[model samples]
Target chain A: MQSIERLVLLGTGLISGSFALALKRARLVKRVVGVGRNIENLERALELGVVDEVSTDAAQAVRGADLVLLGTPVGQMGRLMQQIAPNLPVDCVVTDGGSTKQDVCALFRENLPRHLAMCVPGHPIAGSDLSGASAAQFGLYEGRRVVLTPLPENDLLVVEWVRQLWVSCGATVYEMSAEQHDGIFSAVSHAPHLLSFAYMNSVLDRYNAEQCLDFAASGFRDFTRIAGSHPDMWRDIALANRDSVLGDLKANVAQLNHLIQLLESGRGDELTGFIQRASRARIEWGKPKKG
Target chain B: MQSIERLVLLGTGLISGSFALALKRARLVKRVVGVGRNIENLERALELGVVDEVSTDAAQAVRGADLVLLGTPVGQMGRLMQQIAPNLPVDCVVTDGGSTKQDVCALFRENLPRHLAMCVPGHPIAGSDLSGASAAQFGLYEGRRVVLTPLPENDLLVVEWVRQLWVSCGATVYEMSAEQHDGIFSAVSHAPHLLSFAYMNSVLDRYNAEQCLDFAASGFRDFTRIAGSHPDMWRDIALANRDSVLGDLKANVAQLNHLIQLLESGRGDELTGFIQRASRARIEWGKPKKG
Candidate 1:
């Protein structure tokens, strides 16, 4: 087994910083070097001991690194890949923390060297309402799922090494085709966020129309809390995962309209039953243990 | 000003227990008496220091109390109101912690003594995903909104006393008609829950169809966390506030359909822009406190 002692963490925001913390907490990585656009964020990540050192240059951060974790916004991954491709270590296992896989994997294939069979795309299912380095905490990945989409052409040893990295970080590893992973998350993750954002904005618009802030209550607060998450990151996710997102959006709206029609026809029982079914399922899923 | 030395709290669950803790924390009441259906809950309230004493008898708890808080569900409020009406002191100010006001206020008016003109209908706009006495905590109402809807025929002194009570408990008080208050919350609070519940159920159904449990990530977890809250309580809320919830549901679904159309038609910019707008508004609303 290859020892992932030296790790390069690109982007020290919620996802990257959290990956850093998770790695250290699980004793999976001995040294972490963080690279990001924001110097202050890098300083904060270092100050929190999420990383052993920081660098402004992506190439410098990637040098001699055993594992490189790309946690940038999906839209930015392509540009970063092109910039770091030339300097990437020959045998280094490169992985990403992008939520949307299709685009990031496409960029990795387009930009990286042939030896980049070592490139593994990863998406850890963990986060909070907070963002940036300040919100980064250890144990964020404990018991969380981490999905990996490895190219078929990739060496088995490299794939297992990447899986071992995430497994060591306390994340349960699941492997799927990039297309399958993208479609699933588009329906489950990206689509829900789009709806939440749209639903919250719709409520805000109504409140603004009444010229009253009175409508902002506990329900609205809970419903719209995710709306306060990083906008740029979401925008990138939506755009990169456009096809799946569009399909999911269509299905979601159709579902919502079905509920609306039930309400319009005054079918209280049907609506109530529908909500009850969903509530029961959600309860069975159980609360995600707080870190 | 009427002396508020001892406070008597009915229901002793999340709302009542939190109120008890807030009262004690603020030193607004010298003692708190708890009444509930379950002795265990009452004991839990006592254990949490939310009350000085516990009683299963509603009438016994109400007698000689300067302030009596009815924190039962809206559906049960009328029956409980009838039960304690005769035992309530003529001078004791009667208030409730129920969500829906117009219905609860009417119940109070029809059941309580006509001579006791100090009945106040209040809905403290504060709560959590957890419920029952065990979930109650001190300072739950700190910096939160509490809507007080006073009837036209009610004495001003009664309204002011209720206002003073909540003010002393660390809440900013707002006054509105019972009808208006219900309408506003129906659009914001009740409606959001119904939508969230509906969305979550849809996801669960899809998850079942695909035979995929591993696919549910943090996005699904956060999106449906509230779905795990008390089902009976939510069932009552949906039934009692059906009209407004239905109306808001219609509006929300319409808004969702509008975004879906944009995405389906390949207008990625338009779709992403809407989410960005929603995200910005959410951030503005939930901005972290300034130093």
Candidate 2:
């Protein structure tokens, strides 16, 4: 694999910084430029060797870069894409580490129509509660999955290059349509997060919430752990993927209603079977699998 | 602390075996007798020194025991109570480790009416996915909380003795009405488990369920860990605490409905605030407290 001359990161943070560090370890790039509003974080990223140089301007950072990674929250990707669009090199390949894809693909088309052929929207499945440049580490993508939802106009070589970059970072890359990606994630990730948040608020609404929390044990701890996620980021996800998320949430409501009826009617056999299906599936999912 | 002559465990599982081991370690019990339908588990309990003797008959086991711990599922407690009622020593202090208090209290009233004065219904908050006598350990209850929902007919001395016994095992004991215990647990424990089961089943109903499971990351893992719990045990809890669980499930439904409205209208600020409330409360709940 040929090393890129310059790789620029927009919104240097956990996802971007980790990608930068992993690529640097693999010696896949020559110079790394970090762009972010937080000067302190950019300096920390530079100090930690996640990036060789730091730039506060996204446009200036992409001027000579052959690769640009949009690694900010989905809400900020559009403006950042607009900022770098005019200055990006004609051959520069663009990719992202956003959790959502369709909105990102739309942002790319709206802001960088000329660069659509070089743009490949992607999502690295690895996520952490921790954020900012300080949380980045080498090998963060090792054995992780990255889903690429490439645009229809994307150049074959550009998509291959983006896939190879992630592969070099020790991640297994998978391809899917933006719609499919959004739907799958909304079902597995987004819906579960919203359900957790809703459950937490419901618990908090109780008059004896403090007492309830005080007595809550490990089960409560694990179930609500995601409820403690970053509000702004989750809100962006909820809004950006509103359609798919709403569908899953409605499905969840239907499930809960069915459960309520079963409990209300004291259907022991059916209740046991309902729980049995879930238990069996979850237990099977937990088992070690052969390739 | 005075030691009982013999302690009989109604069901030789994690709860009962752990209690017996903890009591033996504190030298507060001279002998431990384990009664279970599974003779293999009974033999394992005896070999591991979790109990000094093993019995397959509840009536035979409680004949000479001065302390009888009903440590089975709530569904089995009533039957075991009926079996031992005629053979239980008049002065035996009967306590239980059932997760649901109200149901267990009713069982005691229905089957062991004559033993109510000596019966102290309790629930040890410590729980594990692992069960059977082989999963018992000496320090399982150390630093754990045990809620004792003593019946009105329970002698004050008997309640005190039960509290003291838990304290000797390094557990902090609390007292509350059986109603309160059921309500609190339904809100925190039972409701979350049921929601997880519902969510899992909802996912399984999807056409691309296998793909969703394949891509489910850490968030799904933690949120559904309890969904992998014993179906029989969870089904029993859901039915045993039906009213409280139903109320919570309904409240959860309302929360989900409110969230759906916010998402449907694309109310970004309100969505952020809703997520913020849940996020803030969950973070606060996770923090170390002074008390």
Candidate 3:
């Protein structure tokens, strides 16, 4: 594979910094520039050797760059794309590490319509509760999956280059439509997060909320762990993937209502059967599988 | 604390075997007789030194025991109580490690009316996903909490003795009404397990369930970990703690409805507020605290 001469990372956080580190370890990039709003984070990125240089001006940072990775929350991608559009090298390949692909694709069309041929939207399957440059690591992408949703106007070579870049970082690449990516993630990732947040809020609404929390044990801890996620980032995800998220959430609500019916009717056998189906499927899914 | 001369553990599994091991470590029990429907489990218990003797006969095992701990599912407690009632000595202090308290209390009153004074219903808050005698460990209760709901007809000294025995095994015991114990556990433990099961089943109900499962990341793994729990065990708990579980499930449904409203209206600010509330409380709950 051809090596990247100048790789620019916008919003240098866990995803971006980790990407930079992985590529550096793989010797795939010559020099990387980190761009972020926070000076402390940019300095930390430089100090940690995640970037060869740091810049606060994304437009200036993208100038003459051959590859640019938008590694921010979905909500922040639009403004960043708009900022660097006029200065982005016409031949530069642009891709994002956004969790939601449809929204990011829309942002690309809205902010960089003329550059759509070089713009690719992607999602890295590796997720963590941790954030910022400090949480980034060299092996964050190893044994992980990355999904790329290429626009109809995208240059096939540009998409292939992005896929090869992720492969160099030790990730298996999967391709799908933007809508399919949104729906799949909504079912497995987005809805579960919203469900956990809702469940936590339910406990908080109880009159004896504090007392309830006092006895909350391992089950509560695992079930509500995602409820401790960064609120702003999740808010962006929930809104960006609204259509798919709403459909999945309503499906979950229907499931809960069905459970209530079984519990209310005192249907022991059916309830056991209901629980068994889920247990079996979850246990099966948790088994070691190929990426 | 006066040591137990003979301890009969009915339904020898993780809780019962762990209790016997903990007692043996503290030199608090002279002998422990394990009783179970599975002869293989009883043999394993004996081999692992979780019990001094093994028995398939509950009534025979309790004949000369000074302390009998009915360590079984709440559903099995009644049958075990009936089996041992005629053989129970008047001086024997009977207790249980059942997860649900109200139902066990009723079982004590129904099957062992004559033994009520010696029957103290208890719940060791040391829950685990692993089961069977092999899962037992000496340190399982080293820092765990035990909630004991003493029967009104129970002798005060017998209750105190039970508390001392748990303390001897390195546990701190709290006294509470059976109703309160049931309600609190429903809020924290039972409801979360059911919620996880429901969420898992919702995914399975989808048209692209397999694809969704393929894309599931760490968030789904943690969120649905409890869904892989022992179905029979959870079924017994959900049914045993029916009223409280029902109330909690309903409250969760109401929470989901409110979240749907927020999502549908595209009220980003209110949705952010909702998720932030849950995230703040969970973060607070997860911090180190004095038990």
Candidate 4:
């Protein structure tokens, strides 16, 4: 694989900064240019050696870059793409570390139409409560999974190049359509997050909420861990993936109603069965994966 | 602090065994007699010093006991109480480590009417996925919280004795009504378990469930950790605390419905506010308690 001469990072935060660090460690990139609105974060990225250079102007940063990574919230990616489109090298491969892909695919089409053949929308399944350039680490993607949703116009070689780059950063890459990615993530990630948030709100609304929270133990801590997530980022995700998220949320409500019916009817046998199914599946899922 | 001459455990399991171990360590008990249908567990309790002796007969176990701890499930407590009613010494102080207090209080009223002054229903907040005699440890209740719901007919001294015993076991004890105990636990523990189970079932209902499970990460794992709980145990809790659990579940449904409505109408601002409310409350709840 050809090494990246100049790699431009649209958002120099945990995801993109870590990617830059990993690529630098693997000696797969010649220079990394960190671009962000926050000058302090850019300076931190430079000091941390996550990037060889820093730029507040995305267009200037992408002028001579062979690769551009859009590693920001889905809401910010479109604007970033538009800012760099006029100056992006024609041969530059554009990819992303966004959590949601369908909206990102649309953004790329809307803002970088001429670079569609080089755009490969991707999502790295790595997440951390910590953010900013300071949270970047060289091994963040080690043993992580990355899903790439390539457009029909995407060059096959360019897609393979992006996949190999992530592999070099120690990620297992899988290919799927943007629609499939949204559905899978909505079921596994987006819906669960929303459910956790809603459950937290429900607990807070109780008459003895303070007492309830005081008595909450490990179970409550683990169940609501994700409820402590950043509000703005999750809001963008909830809005950006609205359709898939809504579908799964409705499915969850249907499940709750069915469970309520079982409880109301005092059907002990059915309730046991209901709980057993979930318990068995979760236990099975928790087992170490077999190679 | 009158040292118990004989401490009888109605069930040789984690809660009871731990209580016996804690009391033995404090030298507050002279003998511990473990009674269980499973001869192996009883023998294991005896061998592990969780009990001084083992018995298969609850009536025989309480014959010379000064204190009897009914550590069996709520469903079995009534039967155990009935069995020991005839053989229990007049001066014996009978208490229990049942999770739900109202039902246990009723059990005391039904079978040990003459022992009402000595019947103190309590709940030890310590829980583990593991069970059986081997899982019991001397410090299991160290720094843990124990809530005692004393019956109005009970002698004040008897409640104080129970509280002191728990304190000796390295626990902080609080007094509350059985109704309040049930309501609080239902909101914090029981309802969360049931909701997690329901959420897991909902995810399993998806056509891409296996794929989704394969791709699930930390958030899914933490959210569903409680869903892997023992089905029979959680089922009993859901039934025993039926009214409170049902109310909380319904409230959760209402919250989800409101969220779905916002998402369906594309109300991004309102949706952000909803998530923000939950996120802020959870973050606050997670902070260290003020001195």
Candidate number with greatest DockQ: 2
DockQ of each: 0.39, 0.91, 0.87, 0.85
- Model number 4 iRMSD: 0.8
Checking candidate 3 for backbone clashes, the offending pairs are none
Best by lDDT: 2
**A199 Cα displacement, candidate 2 (Å):** 0.3
Query: What tens-digit string does per-residue lDDT give for candidate 1 at B54-172?
Result: 99888878888888888887877878778888887787888888878877777877887483477888999886777789988787888998999987767898889889878887899
TM-scores, in order shown? 0.80, 0.99, 0.98, 0.97
Q: Which 10 successive residues of model 2 chain B have the least lDDT summed?
A: B282-291
lDDT-best of 1 and 2: 2
Return the candidate ranking by lDDT, descending.
Answer: 2, 3, 4, 1
Runs in model 3 with CA error above 4 Å?
A: none
Q: Candidate 1's residue-wise lDDT over A249-279, tens digit each? A: 6666666677667656766577667767877
Off by over 4 Å in 2: none
After superposition, candidate 1 runs with Cα above 4 Å error? A3-69, A79-93, A108-116, A128-144, A168-170, A208-222, A258-272, A287-291, B4-12, B17-68, B82-92, B108-116, B133-143, B208-219, B288-291
C-alpha lDDT of candidate 3 relative to the true structure? 0.92
RMSD of each: 4.7, 1.0, 1.2, 1.4
Per-residue lDDT tens digits for candidate 2, residues A223-265, read 9999999999999999999999999999999999999999999
